[model samples]
Target: MITSTTGLYLTAFLVGLLGGVHCLSMCGGLVGSLTAGLDPRIRRDPWRMAPYQLLYNLARIAGYATAGALFGGLGALLLQLDAFQIMQRALYALAGVVMILLGLYLGGWWRLIAVVERAGAHLWRRIEPFGRRLLPVRTPLQAAALGYLWAWIPCGLVYSVLITAVSTGHPLDGALVMLAFGAGTLPNLLGIGLLAGAAARIAERVWVRQVAGLLVIGFGVHALWSLFG
Candidate 1:
């Protein structure tokens, strides 16, 4: 049987993959723009551009992993406080509901997800300036740095996944979870950066988005049921 831990990782990756579809819908142009910012020569040569793209994503994933670790650490702290059992239950329940909201956001059903994102904007602004300094990237390090900044860009998808990270209640566990989520998002963001329109088209398929959304909802339901069961 798949360990519950492994299952969580798989789910995180799936969530990332599904989020890619959403990214294509919402951030396709942004992906394209990242490429546009690349050196013209690199942009023109596929072989040359591959490394830069990879570096950018690697950085982004690193950021996600780091964030997960922090969230997990906080969760761990929260779990140790008074009424530990109640706190754990509450945390899991919150995660379940957030997952449902994520599914809705992915399905284009509940746009309210953005409210969470807007809350993160304050943090993003603080980091945005630093990211700007690396713009028009000329080196792998620069690309990676830019990606680290990109990871902080507020999105409901990320926040929803963080809720899962929070439930892990260990820094390492949280990091691993977010790393999985980041990996899931990789295909979409990476592909659009490379294939642009073609990949975006595939991501934009309504059926694909709906299926991913339903799966997310199922995860949430399962989570809640487990709590009550």
Candidate 2:
């Protein structure tokens, strides 16, 4: 159960750390495209490419934390209304339920999470063209701007952890939770952007994703138990 601020942050981080393995396939193409957009000079030199990649991903993480803050604030605001105390509990429970389903989605045992993903796909489609406008990035700031837009890109993993963030009912705590989650993903996504071929192979392996998926499932179970246990 994510009863404490630190526990929530850790849970969010674990979700991103373990679940990010799946994003290799989902976001690898985007990472590739982002890299490919860079000048050939940067592509040829690993040192030059590092800063741009880091900036882009950091901006993306900022977007995640921003969303978490907004949603958490909204949740907090809602709680100010009468009879909303129970609603807060419902939100937390819903977070746990969605998390379990997301794990199943990650594990390839179910596709229920796609419903959530699809719900936002339209909004993502609208936001995606903005990223295209920044292609062939000339500066780290430009890449970072593109990343900020891409943060809203639809993905079950992001959405799963975001739901948990919202349930925190505090803007700062929610932002912190998402920040930790984003940090967890930093390693994997940065690795994928740097080593697409190797990351692809690892992502393609069935057992690798399954193991990571199971851990995510366990997190969901733990979250639920924390609520009721």
Candidate 3:
């Protein structure tokens, strides 16, 4: 079970890493706005901008971990109910299916996940004002706040991973899963000079997304096979 859990963590990380293209597509404007808000002196100097970038991303990941814990606890509660106990395996199965759908979505083969994102839009509308207030960020704290707010944005990719987090049925495990995933995404969102540009270019290619989608699909298949094989 330990090994299996660890494998799930790895898969989560890869999903985040490989999902960079999607992230770029979804949040590219936000990332641009983040940098744009920085003082010109800091923006021009990589050293100065580093701390702001790091803090915001870290805070964003923290938001994900917090959400994971909430969903994980919800799963735990459902399992605790006598009538709902049987739903545990069903949740896992659903998670696997969601991953497969996420792969298809990432590969541009399907877009059903957009409906899930749209469902969250109303909540985002409420939270967006807080993020806007933090804009033109001068302090790391303000940037962090903005990043945390950004985490709640309607994102199908994030919701897909949250499905897997719910299947974990443990708060710590779910938080860990999201932490690993967030770490994997750190490289792309870090917005470093040349590397960020190169990553963006690479992620834009059709083949990269297809390859990533296939690998994610394989993970989902493996998960389902383990459950029923």
Best model per TM-score? 2
> By lDDT, who's the top model here?
2
Better of 2 and 3 by TM-score: 2
Cα lDDT of model 1 by residue, 1-229, tens digit: 1127787788788777766776666556545656888888889887888888888888889999999999999989988888766776787788778778878877778877778779999998999899878876778888888888888888877887787787777899999999999888888777877775788777677788888788888877888888886
Model 2 gets an lDDT of 0.83
45-136 in candidate 2: lDDT tens per residue? 87889998899899999999999998889778877889676776777788778878878877888988889989999999899888888987
Question: Model 3 over residues 1-229: C-alpha lDDT tens digits?
Answer: 1136788688779878877667777776677778888899988888888888888888989988998888888777776788664576676677677778878887889988788789999999999999989888889999889888888888777876787777677898888888888887788788532144665677778998888788777767777887787
Give lDDT per model, in order.
Answer: 0.80, 0.83, 0.78
As for model 1, its CA RMSD to the true structure in angstroms is 2.2
Residue-level lDDT for 149 in candidate 3 = 86
Candidate 3 regions exceeding 4 Å error are: 1-3, 83-85, 192-197
TM, every model = 0.91, 0.95, 0.91
By TM-score, how accurate is candidate 3? 0.91
- Which residue pairs come into collision in candidate 3? none
Local error of candidate 2 at residue 147 (angstroms): 0.8
